[model samples]
Target: MKYFAVFFFVFISNVFFAQEKENGTLVNGIIKDDTTGNLLSGVNIINVNTVKGAISDDKGVFHLQAFANDTLHISLLGYKSIKVKVTNDWIKNKTTTIQLTQKAYALEEVVIRPYVLTGYLEIDAKLIPTRENYRYSISGLKEGYEAGEYSPNAFGRVLGSIFNPADMLYNFFGKKPKELRRLKEMKKDDTVKNLLASKFDRETISALLGVSKSEIAEIMERCNYSESFVKTANDLQIMDAISACYEEYKILKR
Candidate 1:
């Protein structure tokens, strides 16, 4: 009876330790420039699965809560972004260092020709291309508009996302309520907004939201955003669109 009691106590203690490690722990990390070996500040660090974020201080040090296997996306303007995975070692050691490579751009020479006004309404109107934006809204849902490209099936797409219980948007955003809940938090952070504004690639947003690039494109399409906007808009614009769409989705489901 004494032996059995000792074994049971040991088993329970081991099980609790394993579960605590699996859930996660706070990890400390430092960011630096790969070429210069200097500490980089204001870098964005986000846990993709948890949607929890941290920014590197002036000393390029940051700390975040992360589980083993969780992906951490690190990004800074004018530098190539990189993702790092949290290993069991990282949780155990509790510290890591990441270095980012700066992006280079070549300047191209160009000749500029200024447009001259014809001073005639008909001639000027013909010379200048007109940009028209269209807005489409569903009957029962809140009012909103899709700008840039117009789709013939826009109504059907928006209606399906709202009315169909098993739609992709429903499954995608619904299953990850905690992740989507951080959209507002990301939007409110100026550092995040600035970083996203400079980036055209959907990597940061996709990683932060735990979605793939293809899935992001589909979500935009379903939300009635045009192909042109999805292709050209920066990550900040995409984040805003997703937030708006998610808000509407939450309202409709309620």
Candidate 2:
């Protein structure tokens, strides 16, 4: 009878442990602005398949129960949305922090005028001299509008007829050029962040490079990850960057 009771107890305990494991993990993380490094609240975070989610509090902390197979989608207004892959570390720490980059707004041929020309006709206006007057006028001759020659003014008009003011502005400014340095990486989604947090956590990174756990902090610093790389690179590209950084660090140390 005692042996049967012991067997029943072990079975019940194993069943409970299996149930907990099957329930998956409760993942938690903080949200922040990549550019300003400020906490973001009220951000939406949801698991795509499960639809289980949470919103960040004033402190940017949030929690949601999710499985490793789940994809957590995070988003906010004026910022790009991100998808984070659930990982064991996320389940363990329950306090991962992620920075969301703000989206850049490009002005499309903006012409801001305080005064409304309500009555005026929205049309191009040009004054041209009569033929005889143009022939005698110094301004017309200097302008290459001489009567006997091909009307340079006619060509100018033709060019202006097809001209796009936006194109002209772009030409002057060189293709709406965005200064990469001036442009903060608020646009990058969370693929890289998730990669860093999941794949390069202290344990994983330490094992990958055979580094001691005590040196993980120094290893992270030595890698010298850039904001742009974090924001822009795809998974494979980020991995390459990490590998390169690790190699360089080894060379320097030796």
Candidate 3:
């Protein structure tokens, strides 16, 4: 009877300790540039198992709750990514400092030439001429005229394309002066909306907005971005789009 009592107590204590260990602990850390020794802001720190994450503050500090043995992925733009384990010792230390190496890239060499030819006939605006074919631009234009090679129709069409009359008409429709300006603004807005949709997935949107997957659709729909607009904006521009759309979402909630 005595032996069984001790065995039962030991088993129960072990189970309780295991359960406590699984609950995880909060981890605090600072991220720095490996070489420069400067704090890195906006660094993404994510738990490999739970997907829970946090971004470093201006001081390059982050705190995240994670399992004791979970791996933390740390990443930032222009820096090499790294992973750290949330071991028992790390937790006991309360906070740790990690440095990330910068990713270096070798750029290709480039050669620059004159912008305009003095009298080159073979080369057009497209730069499609062969390397061996070269001449002065003034001489080329003079010869073209002497040979009666100039076509008014083609030249007129090219000039018209450069100075589009439709663009003038566009402003005329919108109170004359502001019509073109308004159209440009509308185009920019559409570009922003499409940029957000393309760069961010449903999960990413949820993470940013602090919303669930089901709520993302309605929020995105309210953004009013066209599919074509997304193809126009680049990565950096897309961040501005995300901020604008998030503000729009907040407005809708109000």
Give all candidates' CA lDDT scores: 0.79, 0.50, 0.52
- Position 244, candidate 2: lDDT: 40
Residue 113 error, candidate 2, Å: 18
Better of 1 and 2 by lDDT: 1
Better of 1 and 2 by TM-score: 1
Compose the digit string of candidate 1's lDDT tens values, residues 62-157.
Answer: 998788998888888889888999998888889988999999988999999776779998888888756444554422226644452245664556
Which residue pairs in candidate 2 collide?
101-186, 102-186
Quick one: best lDDT, which candidate?
A: 1
Candidate rank order under lDDT: 1, 3, 2
Native-vs-model 2 lDDT?
0.50
The TM-scores of all predictions, comma-separated, are 0.65, 0.38, 0.38
Off by over 4 Å in 2: 1-19, 109-254
User: lDDT, candidate 1, residue 142?
Assistant: 61
The residue-by-residue lDDT of candidate 3 on 1-254, one tens digit each, is 99999999999999877865775677899999989999999887766455566778999999887777877767676787677888888888879999999989889999897666646656554564432221212211233111101322422332332345453211222222322222223234332233333443343333333345454333222333333323333332333433444333334334
Q: Which ranges of candidate 1 are over 4 A from the true structure? A: 1-23, 109-117, 134-153, 160-201, 210-222, 226-234, 246-254
